[model samples]
Target: MNANQTQINSLSAQSNPTPIVGIIGGGVAGATTALHLSEQGYNVVLVEKNDSLVSGPPICHLHAGGNLYREISDEQCIELLKDSIESVKLYPHTINRRPTVIATPNHDQHDPQSLFPRLLQVQQHYKQLIDLDPSNKVLGEPDDYFKVFTKQQLLALKEQQQPAHPTTIEQWLIPFAQQVDLDTLRYPVVTVQEYGWSVFRLSAQAELSLSLESKCQLQLSSKVTNIEFNPHQAKPWAVSIHSQGQTQQLQVDYLINACGFRSGSLDNLANIKRTRLVEFKAAYVANWDDNQLLWPEVIFHGQRGTPQGMAQLTPYGKHVYQLHGMTEDITLFKNGLVISDNDSQPKLPTPLLNKIDIGWSEEVVAQRTQSAISHIAQYIPSFNSASLGGKPLYGAQQIPGDDVSLRATSVWFGEQNYACIETVKASSCLPAAIKIAQQLKLTGLEPSHRSSAAEESSNKALTESDIEQYAVRLARRRGYPEALALYYGQ
Candidate 1:
């Protein structure tokens, strides 16, 4: 093994253990969730089909701190995100404190100051839990003198977050990239959180699946083939998991079907088809080379609609970027959840769904790959010398796959059986993990091991119940900035 691989192996060895929790996937979400749950005192056993998920190329751009900070008002989602961010910030063995473009004048985007108000607040929240503080700041000059999240601004940021770094093919983005802080990001520009991150599922359901794996177990390859809820006992659900050619049945209390996009198959878990789950295929690429330029940046490709029809990009590790766009016009995080192979679903609006998946097109891929290079080239005009043979990037993988990924998924979370979806990006994992730990505290069923009286209060952080409102409020119901009414939207 090379020196770098040896180092990574050592780190993974230090992260193994079995808590009372059994995560279903081992991607980013599962990994972060496992770390948080383990820290919270649960003897977590991260079961995955594969031993090491760090192989191939790493996912890029941790979540954007600014993007994550926007949902802080939603208590449950906030804690989970906070915990995930803290893990990376306080590792004490890595480089961080990256900056990112905070906001724009357009709608659908989040303005930094409007989002966090004070950068110090995030760091302070972290210190209360872990002894570490992360420096997350926004950089850039806006045409407007002030701050606020505009739909257009969000679109601009999202647009920038995806589509390979532009500097490789062009040398102009360097100056543009310089204005943004890379350290403050949750991950590279195109990077996915790996947990609780939805590429193809409703935000809530995706979290349930990815969190269990990345957060509960350290395994990314865990996939559930069958699940049955036993009514005989309270909090009764027996889930049959299939991984690496092995199948095992396990019972869960408060069995959460956070099974990503495929969660619709969880009908047995609820004794009925509570919601239909749908699936879409996505892929990504990553690379690590000091010679790499076009500093990585995370991009949410969709200028419109939810993830079902959107694509994403992120930079990871030293220089890893990814793209996850689907065909068949599906919403990875919303409408897609309301339909399944077995369920007769409604025809989604073309605006909300599209058949033009960015992937599946070699021409598009080459164009995007070139765009990624140009993005880097713009950021660092001198990056060409650093470029390795044929660009340093591996093939592509699913966004938070289950069995090893969360299976880009969606969920049904409305009273009348409507698709009340939410988009929880890859960066949200840390905060979600923290929220789960706090939940355990309230129930007094703290994970097998952790408790910090100073910062242990289940009531304050977040709970699963609250997300229903959050989804409809921010995503489905309310209009951007205002014109919306939702106790959950706040």
Candidate 2:
């Protein structure tokens, strides 16, 4: 063997009595898996083509109960609630602790009341989670999981002064009531306990935690070139990675495909055929400097992929907001969603791939961002004044099957000792890791006492201030405003 192969083999040899798991793609799924497996004493090598983790897609909302989407089933909502709570526990520093305002426009056929049943189910499920573990009370009291406001109540609050800092649910609504065009909205509005999640903060936490983990080897700016699997070998998988202008080979007992939208590419390399869909989407960043009042995330529900598509306004600190319009002209692109054919990978169109691999043109960014601004201005007329804050946060997401409506998913095991995480949301990462750990146990690989290492690292304690500092650095490094890393109303 060459010197590089010898070095990799020597490193693999040090992980005695535990398996070496090679995880591809350093997004939320891969990062969480690496941290969990490393804590359990399994040596982990995490590979990401990018410089940072959790930077693939824009994860702005913690879909507690999947309330943002109306078409998903109640079961999915409950699962999302459970998963979101777990995510908050794992990455508390990432949550913005802000509620969301859900409204139905007057022209939309879907009534606001139709969401009550699922909201009730989610509230009860959240109660159950908290009862089992009081620490799961991340969203707030189950009794107040969601609140309803009549038009009269909103009209009364519209004239009230916005609070310096909103401490209660109603206080959070004051700014929304003041700005939202009451005539265009339906009679009653619903505000849920769903909160904002910062991907930048999550990236910061994962990088810091992984750096502290002795069992995990984080390889940023590394791309996997090839994979060879032989069932007879002691280490069944040989993963070839290209990094820093050099190629290195790693021997791992198991392979985990947590590659997000690029997951199908790995399956192709492994000769594992699986049906999946990949959809590319974007959210625009805008600065509304005149509106200093801290506003809750606002959502106007409408049909997906239509002219009256859903308009979402997510607030970051320093008067910065992220906007998503579900229509074709805004967030949703024509031919953006593609299905996998006979090959495991779904080929994205070249132009879309250019936006993902390279970057969007300045002219395209300006046009689309302006369109998003106008889309939001329909509900909040004053939003027309908002200007572009920075480049749009855009990436593609992977769905396991043809169902584009599938919101909640976890780990999917392929052949023996090979697992692929098909998570649609950031919240789904923890449960996927748990299921993978269980599968590892079934394979007769006992967890080491080093499981306490995770707790010990947690004891080291990354304060919110530390997270903010790191998050700002990461945001700036990634060409986003530092305000995106700060929580609104903090």
Candidate 3:
């Protein structure tokens, strides 16, 4: 055995041994890192505070196209897409494979007539970037993965749907339809999870595979309250875990903080100050009777009359859709504590605003929600704000928020063996995982082996009964009658 392998065997005292990595958090970044590490032949103790695997509020679905998709490097993008393909396979019911249509009613500066061609220009740019990766040759072609709607085809389709929810094309795009009549304006570039696929369902799928791994010590309903560090010791750091109203410690050669929003909390225990940058945004879920109104996630640009200059409308299912206004300003902080606001709240005097913790409030959410509803109505004319019924169906409260501030794309403090993923969005978790793996010196495993295993796992099919049962459980937890009816009869 090599010197490193010999050392691991000595520390672990196993005939067949590997180093132990204590992964804290059950979110996408944490889960993916733990899974990838285990596949690299490491002993992973996946610890989570929730009783079930996917423990946490259901936030935004897996939006394949977003800030993460646009901002990340091309190499990172390739890894992200590959990881997403593998992950969606485990729980196909969680994702909607339809093409996402990104449109804007108000063009900021670009000529409106040339907008479709401009979109193609950007697509070609991204497509060229993805093509650079050799692994993609075997994985799939970037062009085939997405479809671009041509303007000519779109004009033709619009003529066929004439005078329906009639509107001049100059004023707005076609109304919501299963297939947008203006296909030329639509691009199937993004995908999201089914609205009802809560965190519990997504996490449970990973927990199953994690449980089957012999080397993994999966801990649930557990909390890591402290970290004991001794630089002189062979294993420099040990984690103090609290679970079942008891406490215990685990010595580790390395550690990774994949605790999503709680990452700052863990870093603080290690005496490292990292900040999480977050925005408090709201969503308004409105009812639409047209089951045929299928839309890939729609992102409308230009903020002229809306709450923010831009709005994103996501379809929860066929009959329900959610609308959100972009955050005009943001609050910055470290370790889950807000430090300052980007803009002063006009209504509240500076002194009063400073005295009160004026973060996201009921008033702000309400105003923004109403404004977003009105803005979306410009295109979706049949949309009525009254149909919003009440508060957003999916609230901001569901997302767990914590982070250790990092200025770089992704940062890890190797001295303390802790890293922070400044996730642009959850879909970018895979690149974060790959980054963590490389930093931990766990890249000894061959790339071919890793690819083969991922491929093999992707091919493992899930049964209909499995998906239906998942729906039943989700229905029970969220109390969604549609979920139960979609699976078991109401």
Clash number by candidate, in order:
140, 0, 9
Q: What TM-score should be assigned to candidate 2? A: 0.97
Residue-level lDDT tens digits of model 3 in 192-228: 2112223434554456556555446677777888887
Query: Which structure among the candidates has the greatest TM-score?
Result: 2
Q: How far is 441's C-alpha from truth in model 1 (Å)? A: 5.0
Q: Lowest summed-lDDT stretch of 10 residues in model 1?
A: 481-490
Give residue 263's error in model 1 in angstroms. 3.0
lDDT of 2 by residue, 1-490 (tens): 4443455667777748677888999999999999888887887889899888889989999999998899998889888999999998888898998889999999899889988888888888888888899999999889889999999999888888876888888888898888888999986899999999999999998888888888788888889999999989888898998877788888888899999998999999999999999999999999999898889999999999998999999998899999999999999999999999989889889999999989999999999999999999999999989998999999999999899999899999887589999999999999999899899888776656775546687414688888889999999999999989986653
Looking at candidate 3, the ten consecutive residues that score lowest on lDDT are 329-338
Question: lDDT for every model?
Answer: 0.35, 0.89, 0.48
Task: List ranges where model 1 is wrong by over 4 Å.
Answer: 1-19, 43-59, 64-97, 101-222, 231-235, 243-246, 252-254, 272-423, 441-490
lDDT of 1: 0.35
TM-score-better candidate, 2 vs 3: 2
TM-scores of the models, in the given order?
0.45, 0.97, 0.67
lDDT of 2 at 156: 88
